[model samples]
Target chain A: MIVIDSPPLENCLGFLALSSYVMTLAPSISRIVFPKYKKAFLPKILLKNRRLIGVFAFLFAFFHGWLLINKRHIDFSDFRTSWIYCQGIATMIIFTVLAATSNDWSVKALKKNWKQLHRLTYLAMFLLTWHVWDKMSGHWTYVTPISMVAILSTTALYFLRLWYEHRAEN
Target chain B: MKSQRSKKRAISLGALMNFIVAIAVFGVGRVVWQGVGLRLSATGLESSHNLPLSAEAVPSIPASHTLDNQGTWIYTVALSPEGSILVSGGYDGQIKWWDRKTGSLLRTIQGHADAIESLAISANGQILVTGSWDNRIKVWDLKTGNLRRTLRHGDDVKAIALSANGKLVASGGTNNKLQIWSLETGQLLHRLPADTWIQSVAFHPGSQTVAYGSQSGQIQVWQLSQSEKPRLLQTLVGHQGMVGAVAFSPDGQTLASGSADKTIKLWNVDQGQLLKGLAGHIAPIRSVAFSPDGQTLATGSQDTNVNLWNVQTGYILGRLNEHRQAVWTVAFSPDGQELASGSSDATIKLAAVHDLAREAIANSPLAHTVPSERESDSQDL
Candidate 1:
């Protein structure tokens, strides 16, 4: 009867998380690796919407968490009982905090700590990787390609930013 | 003024690019998740927490006689009425019969050109009916493993059901036609056109009535009395997705239909009214069967779980998650002690339902507080 269930929504949440991760990474790449290329249209666009993208990612993560809690009927008491459940709940918590503090007011209030707090996105990314891998283990045919792309792109961007920063310092 | 306008334009362009990048990334991730989910459902890997007891933990439902090495998805399984032989047919297009006790292959009968989707064993266990994707229905002598006769259809045969007396075989398929045939003579007795592809069929126990569930989510019951042509009795409508499997309670009072909607609906057969909807599985339900005594109902789902429900109360008694892939069919042995489940993973699992249910009761805290009548009744059975 065309019932809207959890699986499709879960996929959507995964997509939103991925998009958020990429969006958050985009501005850093533009600022560090391609500082001279600031005029580039893609970099400028990503820099402008970085906060919005992060907020969206967090929203998606929240919805994902809500859906899972409702569908699985998970008891919060068992949060420490299962490793998979713990990892997922921890990731959601991180996303919730990041989303709550994504505004300019939090940036002004937390000052330098804001930057460090937002760095938890990297941790969230790592946990999400492990979560997806653990859940979709045998179905590598479907998961591997997208994961490789995300991982390789992030890694390549990180290295490029490091190289550019080193060159500027020298 | 020109420089200020240029700067503003650049900012807008950058915002647009961010939006585009976000959309692209989201799209890729969504596609990947969807693909994985579909593949998991197709292979029956979708996981559910409903089954706390893994296959190994439950010693009662031992991996008795894995008829493996066939190397293809087993779509349908049936145990002989006598419970001496187990027969499974699948994408391999070969029906393999095994000695139920020894777990040894007794015979492999081949005739269908394509995958066999549905199978039914007559009450006497003398005749075996199989509907195949090859658009053919073949009746075989269960004892000899010989094809008695082949009935051709206009499209792939999706489901088949044998009458209690084994005299009539009802089949429905992708052709949107339901045909009743004499198993002995292979003569097509009646052909009824349906609104959509028929995915599952069930014959009412000890009656001339037959039920067929369709892709359009409608369940039709027909009374095929010999005196009159087959008459449409009632249409049970509730399921939102394709009805994958339907089974009649042993007593013939209730009919259970499992659907891709991930719910099992029990209907009062005589009144043709929906009784209760049993919802637990996270994915599509592929098969459903009532225990021999009609007290418990077993449902196999694309979520890779075989869930046992108390038919009277619609409460989940326990879940069997032995299969790694979607469980396509579940059949209780004639005596109702053993529950047989076939999966897309190409393995047939024989579960001791009685023992598993007992263990569930012992493990559950509600054992003392809540008196589950169905659990006790199953134990008595």
Candidate 2:
């Protein structure tokens, strides 16, 4: 696999901005991604293709955290940076919990209680998004548009599903 | 005190008899309620769901039944168009065909190296299709019980569907691709964008329109255009879990979908609207279909019950509670007179839906007689 070249640390101001944008957008994107299936074509078996795709998404986010650790240049002891670290840790914990339990074995072993644990994915998305966006105050131009689109599209999908369901029940 | 106890016992016995009579009458009445609803509105509940008590309840009974091969876990069952045969795909990769009447083994077809997960039958009734964990769709010539063709993909085939005319066969797999094939010469037709492994596919009768539901809780309509690629006509999304099964009514006007979300939903294909939510399955609903006359729908669920519903009103007409395990498949006969359900309980049951017109006509003259009531009144006089 090819790794893209790292740009200059001076222009890396955009990196922090992009990181915040990705973080802020995760909750909205996740809202669209995970849900109780109304008409899931595939019955749940071990490593169902849908579950595998979900695993891939989680893997991509894991790589995102590694990139953040390498990019953030913080002083050894800053109170402000401690908040960001806490958020990062919380996001990592949520993602790890989701990724670990997203398997056929876990689903069957946990049974009726599996859904409760799986619901943590949404909360993780919320923490990850807030952590990144709060750090970028001056960089509204680049982060705002992307995050706005992500948030709006997710909300649209949710509401559209709600409207369609309402018409059916009545 | 003895007189009061005797009176209480008498009242309880009367109530119990009424309940028993209700079940007994419906068990017979539903199987043969032929001309009963014809006097009512065409779309019975579209006008109003306030149906008479007679239409609300049905006594459940066993028709001709078939037994399935059991595994540590039995997966699913599929019925043929004619309803003469029953098929069960098991966790052991074994597929067995049974005589719908006698529950005897007709034949067993083989091709999958792993468990056979999904099976579909062509509308023409000549071909039987199976999708397995080994990632292949094997089409079997039902008469010969011989494997005719094997369509291979990269991932495990999860769900399979055959069009109403049986001219087209579609399969969705782990690869997240929905491929439609021409059954005539075994040619590749169109590879549509299915965003996820499709859980179910249904076709509209008069048109080249197809509706598929995704694991992502999305159902979209795709029309085969005059152009090279088919166009996405509409997206119907709402369910929270995986959409497990879909069926088009005989006329193709309505589409029914069952889900892991534990609801069976009816959709209006023309306007792309959700029409009804047939609820009550405790576990995930595995499969759903309309009766041949489109008067009723049968839904199978992991809850181990096969529910027969009045389609227009959503009232559960009958419940088959025989299966000790999950109910996997439900099918209606082409003539609309019978229903069959297959389950993990290792059994398949056939239910008859005969005409009620005969019963009403035969009993009307007897009801017109007033001599019996007059005899009782004369004694009192």
Candidate 3:
């Protein structure tokens, strides 16, 4: 009998974080790209749960880092040393800060600064692109290329939303 | 003011965008599941008597033997000193012995509870040491198939090296601890802790020195003592990636290290100076071995290739692309006539060293730069 082995937990957690993070940003991109569909079923549901999805993304990313540190013995100092390793570390730290300030209490406490700080999600998205690229560039496995394509397409959608907003203003 | 048709079109586009995002999310899971399915089908094969190499890979060289692990990765292989018996340990947590000359299975030992990461044989081929993800080091009687001793570690073992005299075994792993043990007494001789994962370990063939490569791309050489703690000798830093394999030359003067950075460096074993950096493989190197004569170096990489290099000139003499997946380990027979490579493809391939070298030289444009046939013949003599 052929035994189908399960994929590594680290990879599963990483992919889950990526998916949830993408979900967190999808409503905003859709809002700009398809303003008429703001009241549509899919877009409305996504907008309603965006914050929950973002928090879930942070939790998944947190566990992903925890597994690497606790199980794989990855040194946290790698962020200061290697550029490739630093991308993921920096993204995780940004996600942590965003998650901490995600509450209404902190939103009221920080006021305008909370909005500016939460903008770091875009920075996380940018860093995550490089993190995926650096880890999967030379390695050709079954799931890596798919992941690369997914992350790139998501980033492209984010930029497309920005371009659309700029055009609308003009 | 947008028309109703345009509003309907916008909703469809939004739906399409949502669909794309959903596909991307599910695509990762689907691809990983598909990989598992592919592995499942591959594991059904009984033996890899004929390796399924691509047409481009087939014309290079024919392996003398293809020992199949039935779809589990073969992590490490070691040949006896006499070059007769070959022992291989792998992801299945089983060790298999093969008759090198006839390419026949001799025996199999199931000892490790998890994947066996490394294997080293004694100089006399009497004892075999295996390090595994099971967080244990096992010593086996090579001739009798008896379990000699089991040494426990704090974490899964990634690499191991047997000293030339067959008295000491050095092991390293995820624990960031490199520990030395006595083969006879099975006692921990020393424990050297580091700041990162220790991926590779090696012992000086002629001296009381040990070296280990860590995840931070640092190769640290230590001087062993009988009474006191092991003294840190040298910290060789050059590779941009983790050093996965390190081997001392037969004479024990030069240390060869292979890294995930896709380059191999030969270091002065005593002074720990980087003597030469050989760059040819496009992917991370997984294993490196020096020929018994110390003239040729063999290395395996995730590029699915086994490369043979002239040690003096740092020129690649041959490349064997027979394995379909990442080549995890390479070993030179005691006589250096044949080279055995274990791979993530679940096959251990034995290739003729001299024939591949001659073929590669003839095909290479830089053939004249390498030593001529007469010189190699004389060295063989």
Candidate 4:
């Protein structure tokens, strides 16, 4: 009825991007959240491959966007309608910068600034939450609610940890 | 000691933030991958189109024929009154006609410049009207496959319905404008405005009434007379999501509305009361139709299933899972013996609904299938 007709390939690529992006950040998060399991095999392997995983995530996201634009014949001239997708566009921009700078020379040249720039991943992730929610609220598939819950819970945990740490320090 | 504790807190907070981001990404990733993977095998061709035609059957409900390799999702399908000819249209802007009995492609019309969104055929089977994304509604002579007229719309024409009398064609689209036109002269007789885009339209069997479902989850029924303006009969609003399809029962006393909210509701036409709600689809419903006898309702959905429902009790009589992708449209043959479903997998599947009905009747004593009708009424369109 409401045909949002994206091919399976497009969806798969999007999923891959999400998965890799999560994996890229999962190790450190797990280390802090569950300190006892910080040395776990999965976390160690993920950490070792974190840079490659981040690059792969960016690649998948790039293809996903490209495919949608090409297949849908999206008209960029209609800024009024296109403005609704600003969050997704902004996230992609951050991913592009991260992907471009995922090299030794750029990291050395920028030094401490590189760390600051890479922190943009958090902002990108926050923006993506809004993007997915905005686009898929009414048109939810099985994965939509689960993704929302996991994202929300993890975000909540961050604030909880922040509050607890702040109270202990005081 | 305080500085050390602050640094440790920063480290943990950064890690926790990363974890939160990761969790969100992972959740979305799995949804796109595993969720869609269950419905579609996305590795190679991403569709079962490559499966040998011999293996197309699904246990009880057998696919009669598959119009193969359609290139993209077939958005809409219509069956002739007598049910011998099958017409389908989709993203490629081509209208394909198939012989119902032989399962052969009869003719392909390069109809529009954009994807065809909706299709309707006159009860007499003489006229075929197509609504397209190119902002045009084109009428074709069903017999000769020749274009008769092209009626322009303000925007993408999403829905169209032809009156049973073959004189009036009602169309609505993204412009939030529902326009009624003279089928013969291509003159716009009336234009009505809605709060949002109209996704589906249906004309009452009596030809004096018209109903349309909108993106805002509202269904409006109107009374139309040639001498006077169309009067609003009722505004039915219960669906939580967009109403994708609406069809009037054969008797015109009941209206069946299907919505993206994944539920099919039966409404009392005159009273505008919700009669019954049928919910079996796990995904959004795209199309709905009532059998000629008004005993059965067929609904197609993004869940890749076409469910046949018993209209009286609001129970699922049967389900056809022959489609590997989202079914965009479903239509019952005038005789009510066959069902043709068009899907995003680029295939049109013809199923034996009569047999499905019989099987359901065997399971539920209260259920009934359609009886045979006059043969002359099925003359090839």
True contacts kept of each: 0.00, 0.00, 0.00, 0.00
Off by over 4 Å in 2: A1-170, B1-58, B72-74, B225-227, B355-381
Q: Per-residue lDDT tens digits of candidate 1, residues B1-381?
A: 999997687556545544544554464356446545654543436563443333333232455556672556678989998898999998658899987777788888775766788998988878888988656788888998887887877566889999998889999986678999988788889999899889899999979899999988899999998778888989999999989999998888899999988889999988998888887677778899988777788899877788887675555676777677668888888887888888766788887788654544453444444644443312111
Candidate 4, residue B315: Cα displacement in angstroms equals 1.6
What's the true lDDT of residue A59 in model 2?
48
Question: Per-residue alpha-carbon lDDT of model 3 for B1-381, expressed as tens digits?
Answer: 568886586456545544443443354345335444433333333233332222233235568788877777788999999999999998668999999988888998887766788999999879999998767799999999899898877667899998878889999997788999999999998989876989999999888789999888899999898888899999999999999899999898999999988789999877778888887665678899998878788999866788787776665666777787768899999888899999877899999887654554454435555554422311110
Worst 10 residues of 1 chain A by lDDT: A72-81
Candidate 3: give the clashing pairs. Answer: none
- TM-score for chain A, candidates 1 onward in order: 0.78, 0.55, 0.86, 0.85
Better of 1 and 3 by TM-score: 3
Best by DockQ: 4
Each candidate's DockQ: 0.02, 0.01, 0.03, 0.03
lDDT winner between 1 and 3, please give it. 3
Which digits, one per residue and each the tens of the lDDT, describe model 4 over residues A67-147?
A: 655333232322322465687678777876786666555578899999999989878767767876875543344455655
Over A1-170, each residue of candidate 2 has an lDDT whose tens digit, in order, gives 21122232222433343343334333333333444542344323222344344444444444455444322212112233345357655665565565556555567789988889876655654554465455332223344445445545544554565576678689
For model 4 chain B, where is the 10-residue window of minimal lDDT? Answer: B372-381
| Model 1 bad stretches (over 4 Å) | A1-170, B1-35, B38-62, B356-381
**Native-interface RMSD of candidate 2:** 31.0
**Candidate 2 CAPRI grade:** incorrect
lDDT of 2 by residue, B235-328 (tens): 8776777787788887888888888777788888778888877665655677787776676778887666777765654555566766655666
Displacement of residue B73 (Cα, Å) in model 3 is 0.9
- Candidate 1's displacement at residue B288, Å, is 0.6
